[model samples]
Target: MTEHVDVIVVGAGISGIGTGYHLQARCPDRTYMILEGRAAMGGTWDLFRYPGIRSDSDMHTLGFAFHPWTAAKSIADGPSIRAYVEETAREYGIDRKIRYGHHVKSAAWSTEDARWTVEATGPDGPVTLTCNFLSMCAGYYNYAKAYSPEFDGADSFAGRIVHPQFWPEDLDYSGKRVVVIGSGATAVTLVPTMAQTAAHVTMLQRSPTYIVARPGEDRVANWLRGKLPSKAAYGITRWKNVLMGMFFYRLARKKPAKVKERMIGMVRDHLGPDYDVATHFTPRYNPWDQRVCLVPDGDLFAAINAGNASIVTDTIARITPDGIRLDSGKDLPADVIVTATGLELQLMSGVAFSLDGQPIELAGRLQYKGMMFDGVPNLSSTFGYTNASWTLKADLTAIYMCRLLNTMTKRGLRQATPYNDDPTMKSESFLDFTSGYVQRAAASLPTQGERKPWKLNQNYALDVLALKFGSIDDAMRFSNPGRSKDGRSTDAGTLQTA
Candidate 1:
């Protein structure tokens, strides 16, 4: 007999592990297994080994709600974040439920059976499993590939070129000139950290990006932790951060000029008035149009002030044998060129999805509640907030899924599908952000409807009300009770569609 479970969660990352914990606590009767493609547990944290790799968002929010982050540093490093995730899994015994090296190839949903036939490739070979529900926790990036743009003379460059996604273990850059290409988070992080031991570092960007400086440690959170319990302090700090983030986001959206001025002014304060802040730090777009890069304790600014690192605002003409030639007739010499280019965005973990042997094109479908797809049954994908800590939204999603499962069990329903009946509903891109990665993958992602339930608020407070307290029956249609693969009812009566 083939293996079967009540729920199958793909990817054992933060989302998967958190989902596992919620399932154990809220739905104890349901059997679930996590299938991880990688050998390790930590998804992004484990894969990214670049220097100074850390969470851009605060740990109090990035960390799971069930597990309080007791560390002093609000902004945590990659290794520490990975360890925190591993510890959370062990504490909840979610690790034991995980099957490593199990790469889910595809999932086929059967309406008659009211279950998903999940196919994966394990170490032993092909493995098939049946599940009542499928949860896609796999992250939004292409793990196998990073977005590496082609430079005209990249092949002629004699120096070692590296992408942050696949950082080589033994590669050394001590006392060597390094040139990091990009103005995004990865480039900002690499420039400062690499400047510590490097002879000189230059951050070459096609255009400037908004960069912010913040303290690595949270004073309020640390003080609260000392006075109150771990969980209590964490909760307070989490709300504090969430509200503050929301306020700033709203302010930015409402008054883009004011927010942009304040952000640029802060950068000017860090670098002296003598510095060319206009050319090096100013971005043409409004605040929050793209993600603003955060540097802990103003390390990137300090590096530049110390003469160890410099920022060049110019387009890359081509890659030279020993350096990069700029379009503005300037040459940046370097022994190592680090391509801190963005990630290749992926949806549904790149898994081929089908409904009753009919191919499911995610782009054509509409997103329901930011998790489930319109007309898709018994499936949910955990996609975190782009503006705030990913886990803040992810934690809520897990809780909502549990509520959904419990409701189905109570109603004697085996399938819950969100169907869009509004013919006039206008469709928009899944995400409104104009980030390079998001824009690149816009066509491949699902669309969101203009109105409620189908539209994404992206605000945690609003999402909490909608996902947690809102009616699950709003747009969802439930059917199929105790039905077999051949459509024969195994129960006393057929379930009426609701």
Candidate 2:
């Protein structure tokens, strides 16, 4: 017999855990299950194991609002992050609801039954489950593969080569020359931390990324947390961070020149006069075009100043047995190589979905409120903001979803999805910006529509104001239109024809 639940959350990351927690708390009578792809939880944290892999944002804001992160350090490492995820799940008792090793292969929506049939592979064999709703909390990036460009003679390199995503546990790099490829967040992060113990660290990048320095500790929040109650302190802290992030984002978009100058000035102040800040730190695009790498306490620059690290901006021709041959005819010798190359982001890992026996090509469909796929009845996904704390957005998504579910149950609504006449709505893309990974997988993902719910805006305050406090009718479409007369439309919000 196939099991049935009110909701089936895919992926046990922060997003999934958050959603499960909210669902359990709000609707204890409603049955829900979480399907995790891996054997354990902590999606990104468990996967990234390189040295000094930590949160780019402050832990105070990065962690959940319902559950406070009590880590001593403001910036936490990967293990700490993983522990936090696990702890949150355990503390909320959501961990017990997880069915580990159950990877959802496909899901088909039955319009007649108004339920989703989820097909998954588990330890025993193929299993099918029915759920009233299907929610994806899998995140944007694909965990299986990291992007490592094939340089000539990559395999010919004598040293042990490792990607930050799948870093070797036993491989030691003590007192050894290390070459960290790419100037993105991961490379920048690896450079300083690896320099602490390695013989020398070189951050090699073809193009530069915008790097900015921010204090790890939220000074105002720390003071407030000490002075006020925990809940009040967290509320104040969250709003403070949210407003700041929104203000800066708006400044960058509106007054780009001033923001650009300030960003450049910050880099110059940290790197000093002699350093070629323009060549390395200056980005070709606008400040939020790509994610701005956050340097806490000026640690990355400090390592560079200490003569332990060097930033090299040059094209790599190929790898040699002894070293990497640059296009400038310079050779950077390394005992170990770390490719912090970006991620390979695939939406839902190419998971197939069918609605009423028609295959759904997400790229052609619209995205509703940047959370749920249009035409994907009774489904939603948790994709956090590229800027600000991810948890802030995740928390909002959880709340909104729970509210929607509660409203549905009250009204006797069976299903809900974005109702759009134009299938080719040009405004479905959540992210308007372009990057290597995002662009490559664009065709495989859902399209962005031109209007409000279909178009994704990353503004934290705007989204929170809309998603949390706003009316549901503006963005959501609810229905129990075709149910029999005997079937009660118990919920008032559930749309019914006169």
lDDT score, candidate 2, position 106: 93
lDDT of 1: 0.92
Task: Give the per-residue lDDT of model 2 (tens digit) for 410-494.
Answer: 8778777766665455664566666677777777677667877667777777787778886676645687745457874232335
Residue range 413-494, candidate 1, lDDT tens digits: 8888888877999999878888899988888989998888888999999999988888878888777646567867543343
Each candidate's clash count? 0, 13
Judging by TM-score against the true structure, name the best candidate.
1
Weakest 10 consecutive residues, lDDT, candidate 2?
489-498
Q: Pick the candidate with the highest lDDT.
A: 1
lDDT of 2 at 241: 74
For each candidate, what TM-score against the reference?
A: 0.97, 0.94
Cα error of candidate 2 at position 419, Å: 0.8
Candidate 2 local Cα displacement, residue 238, angstroms: 1.2
lDDT minimum window of 10 residues, candidate 1: 489-498
